[model samples]
Target: MSEQAQQTSNSYRSGPDERGHFGIYGGRYVAETLMPLILSVEKAYKDIEDDPSFWSEFYTLARDYIGRPSPLYLAQAMTKHLGGAKIYFKRDELNHTGAHKINNCLGQILLAKRMGKTRIIAETGAGQHGVATATVCALFDMPCTIFMGATDIERQKPNVFRMKLLGADIRAVTSGAGTLKDAMNEALRDWVSHVDDTFYIIGTAAGPHPYPAMVRDFQSVIGNEVREQITEREGRLPDTLIACIGGGSNAIGLFHPFLDDPGVAMIGVEAAGYGLDTGQHAASLSGGKPGVLHGNRTYLLQNEDGQITEAHSISAGLDYPGIGPEHSWLHDSGRVSYAAVTDDEALEAFQLCSKIEGIIPALEPSHALAHVMKIAPDLPADHVLVMNMCGRGDKDIFTVADKLGVTL
Candidate 1:
């Protein structure tokens, strides 16, 4: 048997061991100065891991603040259009701030309060996480600083305005393609310089120990909800699950809950900016190799000399060079399949869904929908498929309009 098959033959959910090593993919590899802070964050998280009150507050906020149990709606029009598997949309796009980013933001902000950190720092790409972080900070009256790419700020102007309206201090990073990776680099630098009073909430499930796991645990609400809702409606679990991945928070959130279910398959769609052949894409797992970045060992788009390369994606959110370490492990272990969707394909799917379902999906999740379009028609009609509508496309209207040559 293959090593990957051996890894998956056993339990799939028990991972990241004591030191947060998910089959050598996840580990804390930070500077010595940040080690204590990282360890402290880990300890604090461990203390609240099984605490009833902490989770009580979390659920209460999920229900009242961010809108929990978003919805599981079968896309009858899209399903009939596909003429194959019944497609169900996990409506995370309907959440507060119009995206699934609010789920992780809410959890980490609460943790920040528990840690007694008075200031919050975060990195954003597509700006949804920035808006969500700013929203939570506004609610708690905590000062927030968001590091976003100058490029992303221009393309995602609406979300930038929303973040500013929420009173977040927006720092535009101009280094390294001026995208998500650069924004994350700036956020980490800020965290190290002001470690005393600031809590850095890394947006995705990509960062060092406790973060990838912590983010997954918080976002797992999506998959957990899918399990209950799908079983209630369909009387069985979904046959397949799909979601887009950059640092892979949303995809991991939906797939983690069902990792041990051998019968259920999961597919993670990565952004192929132009096409994989052009080397101008962000399909890390499909095109990159394992390397340490943002403090964890994961598949990264790097050159032969081991320098990280720039990733391109029409969707600002999926423009990262590496994925979350857990996702790297899952991809290697063969528990989840990774696919690439080109910018053109995603753009087509974006418009198709908007016209058919009246649900304008963000460019990120549109990548997943593109893959679903490719395979759904080939599957049996009774086959059930669930895809995470991770974010709304209102933030992308301008970008879409420009791409379609319709000036706004």
Candidate 2:
């Protein structure tokens, strides 16, 4: 990568256009009350992006405080059995609070302060993002409220306790399926009710317009580091980059910077509960049609009428009916190949990685691992593959243990 090339890439890294639309997929979709604040945020971000000093400071915070440029470790043992391409784990699991959600949380907290917003609110499922948001809110000494589904609060009890300890007020949403999307709806309702001073820190890259764009920009550190590190380690960009799509944030972040790289292959794996054929799946791309849901025009697992269907997946995180708009565009443009993984297959991979690599991956990444099991056995030996392990599995112990017929 020459200086000229690097400059060109960075120039388009956050853009091919601003105003937060990614090829007509993303734009600011907000109520009248938030229009001014959203615009102000857009302007402030543009100003900050232009300031090199701000980036220097932000980079310092990322490296020293948040512990970033997270390691891209070669899964030597896993790859040896899978045969072909060397496997690399972009270990976002190593980040604070056991997931990559911290990257965006910290960045959002900083942006909220820059915009003079004092209170922060967000939605969470599995409580990973909630914990991350609570952690940052604690660090910033800001009032934080997290709306989580009642079911998640029950299942992910440890994380809920963690959030309370971090001083976040947890609101349990009981309507709908009592899961991630339900919590999102309640969170959105809260935002609409209190649109004055509260900043909505959306956990994923799925929300309307600027949020998906903003979060992706903040999380692009994964791709930025991958490009540099892979070039040094394997002497080139990876042939295939994979990440699990739960609201599509992490996948979009890692894939966005590499989209224009023609030689790079990208994959987004969604959760397939029982199986797509069984109609009990969260395979949004495979089992869904394009529809408007949760503010973005994206593929959603909807029914005959307009009502959103219940999403089912063993992986609590990927159990959503809709994906981010950018993912919908990527699917339409053929920029990304999307696939589904069965709950059974995911569990197998979850156990396999634990036994082999000594890594306990979140069920979300287990879907990606399921795909890797199939894809790796076929690719050339020298081909390289990288997958983002988005989280750890401590929050999933009860579910996994029961599924395996074990008792505490």
TM-score of each: 0.98, 0.94
lDDT score of residue 195 within candidate 2: 67
lDDT of 2: 0.85
Clashes of each: 0, 1
At residue 367, candidate 2 shows an lDDT of: 89
Model 1 over residues 1-408: C-alpha lDDT tens digits? Answer: 246433433777777788988887989988887999999999999999999999999999999998898999999999999999999999999999999999999999999999999999999999999999999999999999999999998898999999999999999999988899999999989999998999998899988999999999999999999999999999999999999999999999999999989889999999999999999999999999999988999999999999999999999999999999988888887889999999999999999999999999999999999999999999999999999999999999898899999988
lDDT of 2 at 204: 90
Residue 48 lDDT in candidate 2: 77
Kindly report which residue stretches of model 2 are placed more than 4 angstroms away from their true locations once superposed.
1-19
lDDT of each: 0.94, 0.85
RMSD of model 1, in Å? 1.3
